[model samples]
Target: MIKSVIGLFLPVILALPLAAQEDSDVLFTVSGEPVTVGEFRYIYSKTNGQDADFSRASVMEYLDLYERFKLKVARAREMGLDTVVALQNELEGYRQQLADNYLLDKEVTDKLVSELYRRKQEDVDFSHILVSLPSLIPADTLAAYERAMDIRDGLTAGNFADRAAEVSDDAYSKNDGGHIGYVNAPLPGGMYRLEEAIYEAADGEVVGPVRTPAGYHLVLKHGSRPAYGEVEIAHILLRKSPEADPDMQKQRAEEARAALRNGESFEDVAAEYSEDDKTSRQGGYIGFFGINRYNKTFEEAAFGLSEDGEISEVIESPVGFHILKRISHRGIQPEAEQAPLLEAAVRQDTRFAEARKALFDRLEREYGTRKVDANYTSFVNGLDSTFFQLSTDLSAADRDATILEIGDQQYTTGDFVDYLEANARLRSSLERRFEVEGAAESLFDNWTDQQVERYAEAQLEEQFPEFKALMREYREGILLFEATKLEVWDRAGEDTTGLEAFFDAHRDQYRFPPRARVLKYTVNTAEGTDAQAVAQAAEKNTSAELIEEFGTDGLRIEEQVYEEATLPKGVTFKADTRSSVDQVDRNSAVFYRVVEMLPARQKELSEARGYVIADYQDQLERQWVEALRKKFAVKRNERVLAKLIES
Candidate 1:
């Protein structure tokens, strides 16, 4: 209730600024605290959007609401609500959330997402010979790079497919001469480097020794085509068996195709003939699939159909023979429609990390970061093999030694130690088998990056006026919510005597119109049940008793009270009387029993509690605002206000 109430007035609060120029004219003052003309104008134009006409009436109406809002905010501060630990924490949380969006290098992220979306419109046909790196040790990495370069050189003289078949480490594609066939971006995570290489290469151009996590790639771009986006297909499959003749399997597949051609529904034919257990019950549905998701032959057959509901001739694949019916096809979506998906994909890819690293680098330059190499070397030298065992305690080491300096802030050895201890679980993971010296160096780099990001985050409010304004709005919003809840919402709900008295004074306003308490009974007539017998039982007994007598298998009885205008159109009310049973349809009959006909009367407090409470809350809020206005001193500058309206 408090959030809903505050939401009604949030636009005004959210648009206001916490600070303005010292020389700006004061539009108003509440208890000696000034609200500048700049602040008021900013909020007014923002809250009203295009409706902020400089008309005097419009200005005055908003001024009144603004003054009331300020009065509540002032009262909240007087009560020390702003100093509450919970609210301060909440404000900080909101600040962090807002800062996360602002801290990114948005230009880089946008470029990546846009690139992915554009590339998604066309599928790339590419092949690559991957020389797998045995490890990330310098020698192994250098060897892999050299080997990939050697392969690229050989590709210029010899057949690419023959070389790939003999030497490529990618087992899946090497047999097909490194041809992975058509693929679209965004590719899986950690594959961004390969994805980039594939899309950037020209037709028939062999590029790379590109470095990816898996190893180095020597890529050959096999040209491109407009993407075959996705297809929804149902297929009937006849599996190959050594015991059965190949001709028999082919005959079965042809029979299924003939049934489909003879005007039988694809769903019925597939259920009767498809041997794929997973899809047989679901009408052989394979759902929607795109390139690289299935074998090249199956995908080609499925996407080859030009029209929905078109069936393919029996096609052979490695696993079985299939007769496919194309259910639907979806082409590439427009950029705007695809952007959100592209953005999500980009974030999951390795490129997002590179973008963030770029952001950190920019911040490092701006903040004048300098490393204390001597101190970092000292810290790393002090570590032992126990570091990976989570047993190293850096507390006894040089706590005062500075490892990095960013602007006026110094990150000491003690801070680095704290970060390491905090990440002990990650440091102890089975996948990380780093030596002590190497581990310490890696941790130090990460710690330095974290320090740089923190320093940048700390300076956001000071550096960005828009960020400061948002923080101020959220702070005041929290105060206003707490104040209103305490003074109006909670009081109205908890002060039972006051609520009852208020409802009593306004009782006539909540009187019920002429109404009836009715019991409606429905009986299923399709089973030859007697509708007349059900109606007779409903007239004589209460709904619960009727349910017990009829066993409730085909009888449904409900009791409700409805005003005259709201009752069913043909329903007539009379005390202790039942309406004639009427056939609602061929299979159902309904009757209504009027338990009591009620005339207009005052509603009890319990009968209208929700509405009464809402009204009571409004009354209390008005009184509270009036009291606050009396307590606070509000003085508006008429000359400035007049100028604002004229401008």
Candidate 2:
């Protein structure tokens, strides 16, 4: 019975770890339970493949977690909270979610990865010579045309590369004698236009004075070749970066090789001597670089060196001090590796994800649960509740107030909103999202976030498994909104008492930005017109000067990019008073005298009232809900759930 929870792993754990063939010697104990090095090695090999993503917990950690899980399960069984209607329903839902994920594996992802796995990639090799043409040349047309024509004729004559040297104006290739290097090789994706000529041509065949956007290209076809399986080599490098101190690097590389040969660990030497931080820590152990992954200097050194444990002398490159050890090599073709691994990974993920979802759906259908929120409305179906409630006091909050007193604690809604915006956990929670959304809507738009969130959550949960992850994603987003809608805001009664107290306590939050509604005129056709011409044009049309001395400098106008307080850092270009803008657009431009030129500045709270309200509501409701959760007599009873397998 204890085995079922850890069933999938027991064999490997007990087998001394056979996760892979190479590191089958490193062992790890499962807590105090005696385990062997073989077991640890096997786990590490499989896990190492996934090490780039550290989000997933490690095998050792998971083992420790298992111990905690056992203890928790015992406690949960003793409490018997699992039998409560809500708790039972939630558990069943999770179990069903688990099963539905399995079905998905069977239905979708597995098949997709398998199909993609069978596909083949065709590797090709080719080379070409290029000629760049000047755009609309202003030189002597007759002379330039004659020179270009002569080069073309020479290219058609024989030994095109040699002709390219003597006559081709492209100075880069003229010296190299027109060898474009390896086919379809290490060139930037944007610069590989010559591949078309190379791919279509036969070996030793010279083609094209083909004209492309870059220039005229005289291409010689090198035959297409498939990619080699893979290579294995060990190497030591001497780097040549000015920052690398070349002589020191060469000496280090030499010492590294000597240390390796003298029985010191390759890993230790690499960590101490390799200048490249990313690989040096692993003892110069770079897993595998394929195709044109590395630069020529390092790639050649690594690939050209001989087999396992063998080390070469210092090789020079831009990022220097390389000492390498070749572990093993695989000739496994693209199709070979992709097909099986892709198929297996896809199958597993699809089945697990889908079946878990299906299971959840079935459970929900069998024993339904209802979800409720602060709006006094039921958001999810399948439950009974007599009355819904929203805090009446919260509904009346003053958008201008800085500190909202809830019981003894005073909350700064502005401060809370900033915190919420930055919290990673708050942004990711599934069920707690909708209310926050409602708050935001009520702020920027007239829409009430709580209402919108309720409807959205209800509709989405019904669409389960189809968009569960998506719904889960929105669950947090929407709650963040609902939280923005909490009723604590209504408690802000407006009056001398309210305003005086609010102003005195939180007066600092209300600072107004320097603002002006200076008149602006839009000059639609002044494209590249000098500033003086613009002012003259304005004067001629409206008898008012938009700028005193406008000329080539462009129009000098008062503009907005949003509120100054909220303005972005550095030079702002937009209008609206709170924030800075990098550049001004037409929206902030106003066309109108000294008496009527400047407009009054707005108070920050008044301008940002909508935003403040929404943010405040979210903080209130989440706090309220958390308080209620603590008050509830919640318990977890796993007896019924545990009975399933036993039965």
Candidate 3:
């Protein structure tokens, strides 16, 4: 059943019409808003749309929408919404917003190229035996030596996996024959010590008895990877629970099939039966995700299926009963989608390729030799001091033994450092962090990701043609929401008369959760300082003076407390203080005290006035954004929209 959809879709790929000029004459109007030919063509070029010459049918759909839009805008004018203070404020807000995008584009894009051009190729593939306890194998001895030797022999003899299956200690990799396959060139800088050991090995050679805080490792180099991108996939799933009996499940499935055959809803059946509560609530929607997002079994089954809405039969996975439905599949998932894996690969390749090519080109242009000069020795040796901490001090005298060559040109120490420093700068600029006390740099990036903002911007420009002049509509819409919120929603600003009336009308949502008042303190060590000195010191010093001198952030003295679950991480009940989102750190804390507990009580207007105002503003804005939709008569170009719909 699934095979047929793919068989059909593959042909559709071929039959994708050679988009013609007809698509251009097609006019799309949204409430008297004319979507120009240039705009349509440009949009189609960037997206998956029918780019044929515009036709009457194509243009008519847009015209209908344009009519409705005109009607709404006309109504808005009648209501004097254009002159509205809220509208003017909203337009001004987006003016700042649009201006910010240009600066952001330049900042992010300029940094991408210089950052890509750096480095060379040196990779490793190693395997290991990890013992979880450190002290057990600290001293190098015959026993530790013999154990590593034995593991080595087993690996060489094709039985290393069997031995690892029986006795290896690292919970992460022991079961898989000590296999942690090819990472790029060097292992990434931190986190996994075992990964580093593997990267430092030579091909077909055994290295290690390398000590980590966890245990000793004997990594053997096996292989490496050259260059390749990755792929992505998505699927819908049908799952069964452990409580389900095989016979009973099959029977229920048969009943479901009969219902489906009798014209019953697949959604209803899914809602009633799917064990996956998250997707089941949305009628079994899993949306788009990448490979490796699920277990090997689930990944295989879903990608192996084809076409949206095509469901599979009872397939066993670690997560139990599954009836997977294929939704969409993509190639080499977006860098951000499979970020940890894909971006790492791309970054390494970009650095190595750019660095190697530029160096090679420079050498050919200048020296023109197939054999490298002795100067490369100093260049290669210099890297030891520059890039890594070394056990042995390197000297100019030792340069004679080191032979470093790129094609015919020999690299000198100066050349090596030049490239090294250049690469280091690029890395710094791209990865530089401001070290926000609590907020993550990437979290802020994600917040600024313009997901909803871009959509709103595009639609606003489309809806209002003189949008530059009329943007006040959108800005005011947003600002009115903001201003109304500020007036009533200020944390410390609540009008008793207004709140009392609000409370009298809607008392249900105001009922408060059990809460408390917390005096919070957060102390942290600087980066790479893994020691817990502050946590340790807190036990000895509780004085506000000494504690203030200690590295802790002090939140409000009388901050409202929340339920234990309501408190974010780094916060907990203490005899004296509480934590908040502000208390973040790699280092743990000691004096986490809850100074006072406030019982859940009826919420007065004063207590919830801020929230009520915010809610009112949100409702008003939603109403306006919705009303804007009505003002513009809308028409969907389904023929042009096939791509998004199918995906």
Candidate 4:
């Protein structure tokens, strides 16, 4: 197990660089390797927080500790621990973990999230004419795109609805002049592009030929309004009937409202007059509802109630009269409060994928990446029917052929094969349905995307200075942990002779305070046993002897040692004396008999092994650090140090 020495070293590895410094900014050197002022300042500021006042004493104290840390890291490098395969792999793993967050275009993601938040404040009323593609094959897609363009070229404010009704594939809205009602931001997954197009267009503006996963869409904006976020309402309903006049229902609703005005609780009025059996039991609660979930009349009346517990005037929808009481209303919150939700929504939506694709495309172009068409085709053609079963023998295949070139790195055919092997189940499934050529193409595209992403991740250290600094900190932390384990911790524990010697020297420091060895006895009075007899026997006999004599039937005895402070309250310590038996309850009695009272004494090495080993490790670390200081030459720039103190 790797015990962390990063915390022990304190301020050295705590913080990443705030900004890069020049060669002249070197604060000190350990074995000729410069430690920069910027690096020192960042770690010192972060570690001390408000106490980092740059006073001479504080700065010098931290600087001394940081210098020791650097010397240890230098020794680790000299030992060639950095070149060890396991440590190299661990460092790379950490780099990859950090890269995931740095790989995305934060500017683009933030803009998308902000736009979604702004659009969430209002609902857009729009209609779309979908030119449905029969399949996503190139021919079908091109035909759909062309047909959508032709329809868009002829579209205007007057004929859009008519054209949509004639040719649009959406059966739900085609017959209704293509109006799908008012929609808002975060329009379900796979429709983000459509949502963006509609929200971005002006009223009566014809937009799109915008392609979504569904098909191409020609959208017409029909204006927007402040969003009806959601409403929690309880309603009292009066259903219309064939036998009763509609006016009678309205009259009854008016009477119910009058009863509410006359100080009858809404729940009581609803239970008495509400016809909705499902909700009358719940005081006619419909819970919270957003726009378009309920009918226009019910939604408008419910949302129209401005204050909590305010009742609406009687509203009549297709079912009958509804009197709504608003429980609560939730509108759009401010951007800072809403950004997290909007960001989550954006990520779940397809737009996040689109943004990542844009990033990958930019990276590929910047790096001048190219696909080796001949090499890829050759590899794909070499696959046999066994490839579908993931049993193809690729050992004899030309593994060295370069399939892709990104910057100066060439990804070989063997690399692609390895990726395929890793995704064996997915590849086999794809091949079973689409066959080798099709599966090969799909997997190759995915592999290419991963390669591009990896390349971009590799560039992060060069592109972002803070990323480099962070990697350095983690690498050093790992090195320090391993170095300390080998130099201090393992030695302290394994060096039994050295541990005993150290313990002998510090024997007086490790001592047990005055303590009493006592035996507690309990007898269950319900068992009709003599409690006084049990206590008397416990004072002279071991627990095993008492258990044998009493046959272990509710006669219990336990021995323990307690120090003066830890002894039970109201109990006095006395050697060779038994306390008076006290009845614990109707069923039990308890008493303590002290066997022996011992004075303060030194602890054995075995008794204090843990504490002794810890102290020994600290001693070993200090000696090792002193040895390292001698082995490595440390030179400090006093001018920079004095300047830091003044600042």
Candidate 5:
């Protein structure tokens, strides 16, 4: 089934020369429409990948399938299913999803990845005193900058952490004296801009008043060192059960330790005694992990072991008692190999905002971006305190006022207002948290990014021909799905009268095999010699009375309907016959009675509706396809077909 479908719907492959061919280089034709070599090859390539069954299919075999497929698609087009509004909307949605894969600025991403890799080589330890400022409010930003500068001025040697604890707005590290421990570039927790600022400062020197989206910072670069990599470890745990004595946990751990000391295998000991169900089954292997993955105590102990097979003494954590063993440790990987990891980390990090801004800045310069300086200031002046509260609207004049010029395009105050309205909730939050002017400025840049991205996406077809080909294939696929539904699936499901007629015409194709109805009785005897009791139970006058007598002392009875071929082994009975057998166990006996017998018969229409409907649809589709084949003229190029096979 899978092979046949693959033969019919191959995907577009850029490397296939046939997919790039002109329409005049036709592979086949249906009716008056030509099926170009490109179309045929694109479909074929989808089913001709390294592991595809169609990779071994003959050109002629696939051509026959493709011809039928085209006939159906052509009929669908004639029926105008492609013009359906719902289908068009669905296709457009798919196009949007596909666009994401092609719309990114790859050049910028690659450059950032490479840049991050170079930075990842060295780890920097830094401290900072942050005075939070809103980006939009120039006044608040200025105040924050002054505060950072004053703090920088007062920073005596060895006093930066103390000042940071007292003054920094970063609650996470403020209480810890603002110490941001050894951050690698792209900044592990994504302080890329701060990392960059740290690199600019000499070791042990105080620097900046540097501005970030978060605030203005006074940085203290303590030192730098070669980057350290991750570690792999395993542990055997002895959990203290809530109702159990703590000493029992300690005793189990000691037993495990004694096993190891006595030269028993660590994996064997862990398998036998570790209380942690998850890792115990895997020989207590805890896999490779980086920093911050486990509790501080566990992490410290795991990393402390310097060599493989080295073990730590039994240690206790909040969860349980554990003994640790180092499996392996690795140093920093080569930058080239680490680029993808850094890129992924950066994308997920808020620090990517800085990199994104850098990209936008470059775009602005390339596109000759210009702000109408007077118009911007005038716009800001017109805004009142309620402006960010969603209580103000742009005046008619302000709506038309040009705020920015990029390349040959002009953006108005109206454009930015629309963006704000579209993201009203986010804008409201930012408004309450930060200064308004700086927020507006950042929003303007974001609006520009949308335009830039749209422009870039529009150029993709021209910039990359392969992307165009791929999209074309998806477009056809979307159309094909809608067309098939209308022509075959929906029609089959809704045509109840037609289905009944089809099923009636094919009644002889459905049947049932021989079957039987029987009762199986099991009786357990207290005396171990009660086969006579089972026989007497089968001979009872009333089922209820017989059950009351036999259904005691582990006795039970069950009735079932079954086909003759599916009846249980070693148990057989003729109609109206009853028999008993002594059990394999001395205390039990078995007996059965055939209640009735059923002969094979044809299944009713209602009984076979599900299977019949599908088969009927297949019959209808086949007839329709045959009619289409006769109406349309098909021509194949044998010479070109042979070339396809060779390729």
Candidate 6:
């Protein structure tokens, strides 16, 4: 087993010195167990990838951290934390999720994603006629394909839309004469086949019986064009109340236009008058948006502006009139820059299933996934109607029957039944319309995909050394976390007597700066006009009394004890004084009367408990790490250390 594990990393192992390669390239030894260079580099890279702080650490600095880490793992294993049932279950669950990142056909995914990125640079507009059919019914499926093919045969540019409106099953597109609008490629969802067909066809050419989850489609390529990219706009809005007159709203919009013509800053005008609360505060700046994102009138007007700082005339929408100013426009980005986003979007889409199906088809051909036609038919027939009912127990004969053979692996009838039972709870309708042959065919296909993924996962460690290293790191990480929680974190929190003693010792270290116990109130006025009046009233009465006298409406009032350092910006004062000061903008003023002064002093244990506890935990962990280091016989090779420093 050890030799096999080492063999998985042969390529990397061969890069090391002959002595080191044969003996696993030992960088260090903890308690006589070797820590290989490959293992250290794997952890170093993983940590550095995720953490900016660690990425900046030099090899020597990281080596110390890594040594401490291995000591913890060693301690955890020695204490048998790795054998805990809950920890094992948690690790297994994490392993399953992590396996997905490693187990995929990445070369195939990357190629498809690249193809998608290239195509996304050009948008396609197509019209289609659908002939829907469920795949389980072979004859019906063929008939749908034939219908699509027939539609495609006679399709002409002029009649395509007319025929689509008359016969297409797509309700939304039918009314628009089968126009599905502009779609970005690799069409998301089970539309990969359609996307491929659309891209391959010339403008005005008819193509199809393209198969998708929605069934067969006869698609007419309307045209393709360079991407429109995205636009950013700033708009000045004049919101009209439902009760307000439309003419007045239009008049307000025109007034805003006049302000722009008169050379007033657009941002200033928007901030002073625009009624759109969302964008008004940001000087009416609407962030970048793609086509079809905004309402029709807004979208059209925003896109129509050709140059930065160009303003649109009054445009009417349901809300009111808007005056749009062009901010900027972006063309298609470089493929390398856009691929990550495109890949992520495509992977999450259901249409990507077609691409996955393509991969599966390729894998099946390569690995020899053979269905035992006779056994498959017999297995389906043998299943009772109760087989569809999730609650009903199934006693499948030939439970071990090889339904599918992928290379040396055989997927059994028992596996299919297991998948079906586990999945059928939410698919109760399957029981009502269950057909042995058809249901079996659909189930087998889905099961085959799962089996393929599992097979890929099993081979990952051997085929990809990085995957093995990563899994090993995660497994140890899990053990370390559980062990640390039990030994350090949980214990520190629970040791109240020790915690209280620690807090008392550190009380003098925690002190509050000079602060104020004060009465404060704020009043808004045009250019600080009411500043004197408000401050005068505050000096004579309490905040509540002032509020009552001032009728409570539109008066801003508050009273809080604040440290001098934590005071609201724009206000500055020494304690033990009454003062009234105008705001920075001179738009408002604050009134304050210092009731008392708070001198700098040591904080009470209760007041500093949270910080003190955190500090105490850190101290405890430092002691624990020291104890672990002493417990383990740690030895580092000077030669290997030198090599790391040189690298």
Off by over 4 Å in 6: 1-24, 42-57, 100-108, 119-329, 334-341, 344-351, 361-377, 383-412, 421-435, 463-470, 496-508, 521-561, 568-575, 581-590
Error of 2 at 125 (Å): 6.3
lDDT of 5: 0.75
Can you give the lDDT of residue 542 in candidate 6? 72
Give the worst 10-residue stretch by lDDT in candidate 5: 50-59
Query: Residues 546-580, candidate 1, lDDT per residue (tens digit)?
Result: 77876677788788998877776567766787777
User: 1 or 3, which is superior by TM-score?
Assistant: 1
- Pick the winner on TM-score between candidates 2 and 3: 2
Writing each residue's lDDT as its tens digit, candidate 2 over 1-647 gives: 66786998778787654434323322222222322333333334444675623222454454343333333333333345434476556544654554443434544555555443332132344334555555645464444555555565645424766766765666756766665555322123333335445555667776665544466666665445544335564334455776767677677677777787788886677667665666666555567665566776766666665565566665666666666566665543565556666655544443334444454444334333222133222211211121111211122133223322222233343433333344334333422434544433223121122222223334444444435444332333333332322324553322335444544455465555554332243433334533334434553443334444443244545444334454334423333222212123443222321112223443455665554445444454456445533443222223321221122
The best candidate in terms of lDDT: 4
Clashing pairs in 6: 189-350, 189-351, 190-351
TM-scores for all candidates? 0.72, 0.31, 0.29, 0.73, 0.59, 0.59
The list of candidate 5 runs beyond 4 A from truth reads 1-49, 53-63, 97-187, 191-231, 234-261, 264-287, 290-324, 327-344, 358-381, 398-412, 424-437, 454-474, 493-501, 518-561, 564-594, 632-640
CA-only RMSD, every prediction: 9.3, 29.2, 25.0, 8.9, 11.1, 10.7
Worst 10 residues of 4 by lDDT: 15-24
Every candidate's lDDT: 0.85, 0.45, 0.48, 0.86, 0.75, 0.78
Cα error, candidate 1, residue 404 (Å)? 3.1
What number of clashing residue pairs does each candidate have, in the order they appear?
0, 121, 46, 0, 7, 3
Worst 10 residues of 3 by lDDT: 113-122
Q: Compute the lDDT of residue 225 as modeled in candidate 3.
A: 49
Against the true structure, candidate 3 has what lDDT? 0.48
Question: Residue 98 lDDT in model 2?
Answer: 49
Report the lDDT tens digits of candidate 3 across residue range 45-162. Answer: 3333654334555544554443444444544555566677856776666676764433223232223322221111222344566644434533644466566656655355255556
Model 5 lDDT tens row, 389-443:
7545645357888987877778788877788778766666777556877777767
